[model samples]
Target: MTRTRFAPSPNGPLHLGHAYAAIVAHDLARARGGTFALRIEDIDGERSRPEYVAEFFADLAWLGLQWDGDPVFQSARLGSYVHPGERLKAMGLLYPCRCTRAEIAAAATLFGPDGPIYPGTCKHKQVDPEGAAWRLDVAAAVALSGPLEWVDEIAGSQRAMPEVFGDVVLLRKDLPASYHLAATLDDAADGVTLVTRGLDLFASSHVHRLLQALLDLPVPTWHHHALLVEPDGRKLAKRRGSPSLGDRRRGGEDGPALAAALRDGRLPAGISLSRSLHTGA
Candidate 1:
């Protein structure tokens, strides 16, 4: 059976862009007579809030999205990440890095999709594992996995290039697992067959694909839909003060009607859809 998931971080209220992604994942599962799942990605210890998590459920329900089974919270699954991380460490594919963000920025001359890529400053350094962030040796990992490719429902097939992002952090200094490690493990655990989200995350699939190969987990197809942007062409984001779904609900807007409007391309004033496929690094 085909299974899809809408994993959202409970760091803020859900906005229209989030609603669009949720609705797409939910409808895709329903249309295929498959299962739809929701996962709360609340691993950010500093920013995740209980109030935001409560609002996440309320917003999804208000938007007429009923997920199968209870939501899986990433916070409770920290232990599950250790085994995979250790396996990589045993294989000499993971290394402890002590570089701070400022240090990396000072050393890096080139930037990838996610800001300045790490210059592999600690790739060969012998750092204490405790309280240190772990980075995957992208070149070594790709060599082990060989040439790999994944398919996207919208953009078609893509060759996996994990090196584009440099050595990505698999485990954070402050958290047990990074987003790349946790999300990849959770998707496999939940049996998600179709990973649905916005196109801005399209490049992330390459890293996730490599993790799947390294961990010997089941691979899933991806569907990176276009992002919903403001009139200024910036993507809607909670940090940018984008209006939340709760704000709309409190203002008496019908949730189901708004979902239908989004599906039909009748976006609200000052909001438009950017359908371009972002495959660039």
Candidate 2:
């Protein structure tokens, strides 16, 4: 059976973008008669709140989305998250690096690959004196996954060689799983055959594919839908105080009107009116 998951971190309130994603996942599952799962990616215990988690469920319900099986919590699966990293470390595919955020930011400025590109200053250079974050060895990444191919349902098929990402973190020094590690473990464990999410995460796909290769997990299909953005054209973020389903519901706006507002370009890059009209029940 087809299986997919809508995994959201409980760092803040669920916004319109969250509904767009959840709606898409729910519709896809219903169309295919597959199972849709909900996963709470609350690994960042410092920021995630119980209230936010409760709000997420309430928001999804208000938006008419449902899931199969019990919701999975990444915070509770800490042990499972470390298993893959440990396997990689045992094979010498992971190394400990002691690098601070400031140091990484400095390297990112010098290197041209984007913010915090990780200059590999600690990659095989020297062992961290004390506790360190474990990074995947780039050599191992290339050796294991030569090249990756993914067919994004929205943006078309894309390919990337593992070398592009270099060494990535599997485990933080604090011993918490990074987003990449937790997502990889959960997707595989849930038997998700098709992975769908916003397009902003395009860059992270390489890391996920690499993890799949390293863990010998099934490489699922991908569908990267467009991201919802604010009126100012900036990407919508929970931190930016975007209007959410709860906000609309409280305002007494019905589902169709909310859908119309989203599709009428009140928000940027949301589903087009044509798509929304066709998708509505």
Best by lDDT: 1
Task: Compute the lDDT for candidate 1.
Answer: 0.92
Model 2's alpha-carbon lDDT is: 0.73
lDDT of 2 by residue, 228-277 (tens): 65545466677877776677776776765555555454653432322211
TM, every model: 0.98, 0.87
What pairs collide in candidate 1? none
Model 1, stretches more than 4 Å misplaced?
Answer: none
Q: Report the lDDT of model 1 for residue 192.
A: 98
Q: Model 1 over residues 136-232: C-alpha lDDT tens digits?
A: 9999999889999999997888999877899999989987789999999999999999999998888899999999999999999998998999988
- Measured by TM-score, the strongest candidate is 1
How displaced is residue 42 in candidate 1, in Å? 0.8
